[model samples]
Target: MRTLVSRLAVALLGLTLVAALAEPVPAQKRGGTLTIVRPTDPVSLEPNLETTAPGAWVYFNMLEGLLTLDEKMQIKPVLATSYEVMSPTKVRFKLRPGVKFHDGTPFNAAAVKFTYDRALHGTPPARWASLAGSLAGAEAVDDLTVDILTREPYGPILRTLAMYCMGIVSPAAVQRLGADFSRAPVGTGPFKFVEWKTNTHVIIERHADYWGDKALVDRVIFKVVPEEGARMIALQTGDADMVLFPSPAQLPALRRDPKYTVHETTGIRVVFVGMHAGLPPLDDVRVRQALLHAVDRQAILDNIMEGSAGPARGVLAPGVFGYKDMQLDRVYPFDRARARALLGKAGFTPGPDGIGGGQGAVPRVGHGVPAAPRQPAQPPSVHAGLGDVERGCRLLALRALPFEAGAAGRVEHVAV
Candidate 1:
């Protein structure tokens, strides 16, 4: 969750790595307006028909992407100032000659082949086709050059063209505001798009012909405030200069409040707890390894993320790019007697009111924190190892909402 590019790189680089190791690093001053405070609102400023992270924290401050990353996550080149890997299904790039697109058009190579041929052929399809589903199109090779192609040999094609749905828009402002260019968005980025208001707020500004090193904030806004106690009371009443998911029980009183600065990091977003494995008691692989050894992933990273997250060993969260350590060969530790001996070897034992009597209910679907400290620690630690029989495997719902309405109600309750 933390990472609106590390909170706008510490609010547009006032650069404070603990005040550059304690002193002598001050002079950065430039313009002003910052505001932030988001918890929702911003489903599309059209970066390839965005897929929420609040529309990537406002089209990543108005979009640009011809590869990006760095902060040591490697892969650079911005509106493609260089690229090559031109064979195993091609690549090429090269653009960046006096870039433009804040709607005065001309960012060329046919606007990166009309923004990847309108996200590989648009009209209700672009969520950048699930991260450029191995692209396979895009040409141009002249104006400033371009190539792209791919339907194979795609080793994460330059981190999927540095994400934010492979940005690069303004094919003449999407052919002169077609679908109203997704509510008036246009880009080359370092801020531009200036107005949204929908669930109240989203601004942007700067970009005075920006082509690099220019945004020291002359407007940013964002501000939706969908309550984490009203975005910490709009950052303690000065009306927020930055706030996003702040309230892991008031983060130790906002880190002992010295006018607040709480910027912790490491979050590539991964919070698991998925199951439906072809139903019938999760299609028994010893009852899905006894519900991953009955909860307690370090007691949900110490009582529901107050230790600020770190127990997800898989689904790629530890600094992303092909993350591994899938707990190398077996290790699901919290053994409630090895989850009741793998639910009595998937046959469901325990009766005389100790529960698992008829063995069929394992529902537990959740969304964002607060379900009374995960219902007294994950369905009472897997219904105290499957012996609670009021419909055995319990804690069937948590629903805390607002990450795109709890991921569209967990994809319509996993498609019913």
Candidate 2:
């Protein structure tokens, strides 16, 4: 009987210990330090006054917006707990209680009013100031509720406010800091700003008393690394946990290693070369066209740019508005003879093999060879089949007579 009782007691204790271990323990929240490299530093942090997009992204994560967009690009709640659309142009928010700014200020209707009114009445060039113009009125329905009236039926009303640029600010912070908010800001976000070194880095630490679901990571270290080559090296060397823009030149080296996988998210950026239009050689549209025909875009794809870029079709990238793939088959091929023919037609007559004519009807320098032309005055159109190749031909067309014969019209690789 004694032996049985002892065995039973041991079993009971084991089960109790197992139960205790299995019981849901709160998530063990430990702070982590994440280092990221940026190509450039942010110009400013004042939400209403910030113009640069990259800096704004950092600022957005640090502040609360009434509404926010998820990965699917749909509108969702952020600072406001719940909201009701009273009319096409009006909204009422059920504010979340016990929310505090980084500076220990209460987030309320007055805070919203302070941010909006200050932007509207402060300066003509408030970062994104005109949003204040749309507000008809703002009033607190109660201590934890607020109503907002707008001037018009703004489509994507929630989405517009949800943009990263429109982070909410603390009224108390504004009152306390005044104009210096540009140098320092207070926000209700997962991380609070600790300090910044110009063109070097910015550090932020997680908020322990975050109102909603707490953040998984603790601290973020932001560093500015300009070169893609440097960014790749930094990642490999443990200097950076993340790199924003891996330069087009360094894609091959990154793919060779299997221990780390590259994470890419398609973004809304058009990385086209901005043709300077004010130069001389570029004034001749044919030279621009010839150079357009001159480059091996396929070569750029297979070699220089490699996996970093897709075949750029137009000003807008693959997913945005005004994008088309009609020009997929439209490209100037690599035939030296055709390139020479286009130059000849433009009155750029060449001797023997081919080169620009000296001292021709076109303006000439001391050697009778015309200097490089100036950039065209007009912004080159991004219409189908128009590109840097076309722009390059325009730059060289005026130098020789062989290029001028029928150069007024598009011919060969070069076209105006």
Candidate of highest TM-score: 2
* Residue-level lDDT tens digits of model 2 in 38-157: 567777777776655447747765788788877556678887889899988889988778899999988887777666666655665465655444665467788677777678976555
Tens-digit lDDT track for model 1 on 1-416?
12111221110001111110011224766888878776667666886666656777787777778888986688888888888887998988888898887877678888777777777776756766766657777799799988998888988888888876678887777777888788777888888887888988888889888888899869878877666678767666667756765556666665565544455566565545455566566667776676666655564455544454555566665578888867711577666678667767777766675544445323333323222212224444344443432234434334433322344454211110
Candidate 1 residue runs with Cα over 4 Å from true position: 1-34, 39-55, 64-106, 110-135, 141-166, 169-187, 190-205, 210-217, 221-227, 230-232, 241-279, 282-354, 359-391, 394-416
In model 1, the worst 10-residue window by lDDT is 11-20
TM-scores of all candidate predictions against the true structure: 0.32, 0.63
- lDDT scores in order: 0.63, 0.54
Point out where model 2 deviates above 4 Å.
1-29, 130-138, 270-305, 311-416
- Report the Cα lDDT for residue 339, model 2: 47
RMSD of each: 17.9, 16.6
- For candidate 2, the per-residue lDDT at 103 reads 90
